[model samples]
Target: MTASRPDIRTFLCRSDNIGVLLRDPATGACAAIDVPEAGPVLAALDETGWTLTDILVTHRHADHIDGIVEVKRRTGAKVTAPAKAGSAIPAVDVAVSEGDMVRVGSLTAVVWETPGHCADHVTYWFEGPRLIFAGDTLFTLGCGRVMEAEPAVLWRSLARFEGLPDETEVYSGHDYVLSNARFARAAEPDNARLVARMEEAERAKAEGRFLVPTTLGEERATNPFVRAAEPSLARSVDLAPGTEPERVFTALRAWKNKF
Candidate 1:
């Protein structure tokens, strides 16, 4: 039998942060992925009438965990946070490490210790639904800034997702497509796919719709950060075609920081 699909809701919270709710329709079990603000999360739950059952945290960042206390208090939902950040986050009912399984009724998500954006960052990969909740680690057309580790470390963390199928839908924590598109265009000016994606980003922004939950295939074809191993990306950064991908990634990230 085919795996049951989830009902997903995406909304904007606290400026650029993206809030997502994943619901298992069969059981009416709903999980909020990283609460940026309790108000938006509560409002979303109210609008959908889906009772909050779980709050899956991705990292220890303030924006990601600020709403956890209030939301958990309001709904009495169990909180699942990164084991590495257990001490830092508030109201965590379960602390998970890499390879751990978290269940929201019939839906199961495997925890991946995707640190680089921060030491405690973890990605929740719901394999059955082909959905990856990569908070602060990967974004639409961009990756998060390397904060607690080197750029190569961030690249290695991103490489972990390469083994997953291209059809997998990536749900990142932020709405940064516009800025990411600008830097992506500069990183690979000659990439036709990148140009097309830029136009799409523009259209989405004009329509007042968030351009998120981008497919892994779309990210692979256009994201310069994810495409750092490509010879064309190396050449665009003034590096030799055969340069190491990690070195190429480092160069691109540096250029983006200053861009």
Candidate 2:
């Protein structure tokens, strides 16, 4: 599986939002994760010459699903969205929940309900490919804004990914690596890994490159929100030296809101 990785193309849309196209080379089947808008998605599909077979909606956010109807109208793709979010998203033909399997060509993506950014948020994990389309729940060095769940609940929701293989490629819904790196520095200014990543992110953005597809290992080591349990990060944020991980996470979220 590692030798023949799925071909993925990530493009920018709707300001800082991201649109991703994942194609299984074996089957020439492509899946689009979150249609920020129809124009860019259609353009990418046209440029790649890969027919869109599935549209995986991680949540009901307008930026994530605004192009669903148009894309589906054009490609006649099957729409798989979070269960119970059908009303919020248009043209959802199949509603899935945790543990559901979504088959696209030769790949099967397992759904994980990760409600934090919103109650309807979910993530698609392609086990064989080791790729996770983490919509709004997780980002590079940052997590989604908690709008529907308590901070602790969101923290727990994110914790579920702690068991994933380090090599798993994580594709998020936004190009927030630069801003997130800055906030992470505020949390752990002396972290060498974070500092190096910050420099890399700066260069990537300066040259107009995409700053995504970071691995789980990178996130685990340097993501302040994910490493909230570390005493060093707790102290950096002025939390009690031995504060619980969830408590530290809550404080970090509040601080980021103002950052």
| Best-performing candidate as measured by TM-score | 1
Instruction: Put down candidate 2 lDDT per residue, 1-259, tens digits, no spaces.
Output: 3536789999999998988999988888899998989999999988989899999999998889999899999999999999958699999899999999998888889999998889988899998989999998899889999998899878988898899999999999999989899999989988999999999999999899866888999998899999998999899778888899999999999999999
RMSD of 1: 0.7
Off by over 4 Å in 2: 1-3
Cα shift from native, residue 78, model 1 (Å): 0.2
| lDDT, candidate 1, at 239 | 95
- Candidate 1 lDDT score at position 126: 90
Per-model TM-score versus the true fold: 0.99, 0.97
Task: Give the worst 10-residue stretch by lDDT in candidate 2.
Answer: 1-10
The number of residue pairs in model 1 that clash at the backbone is: 0
Residue 177's lDDT in candidate 2: 89
Error of 2 at 213 (Å): 0.8
- Record all residue pairs in model 1 with backbone atoms less than 3 Å apart, i.e. clashing: none
Candidate 2 C-alpha error for residue 142, in Å = 0.8
After superposing candidate 1, which stretches have Cα over 4 Å from the reference?
none
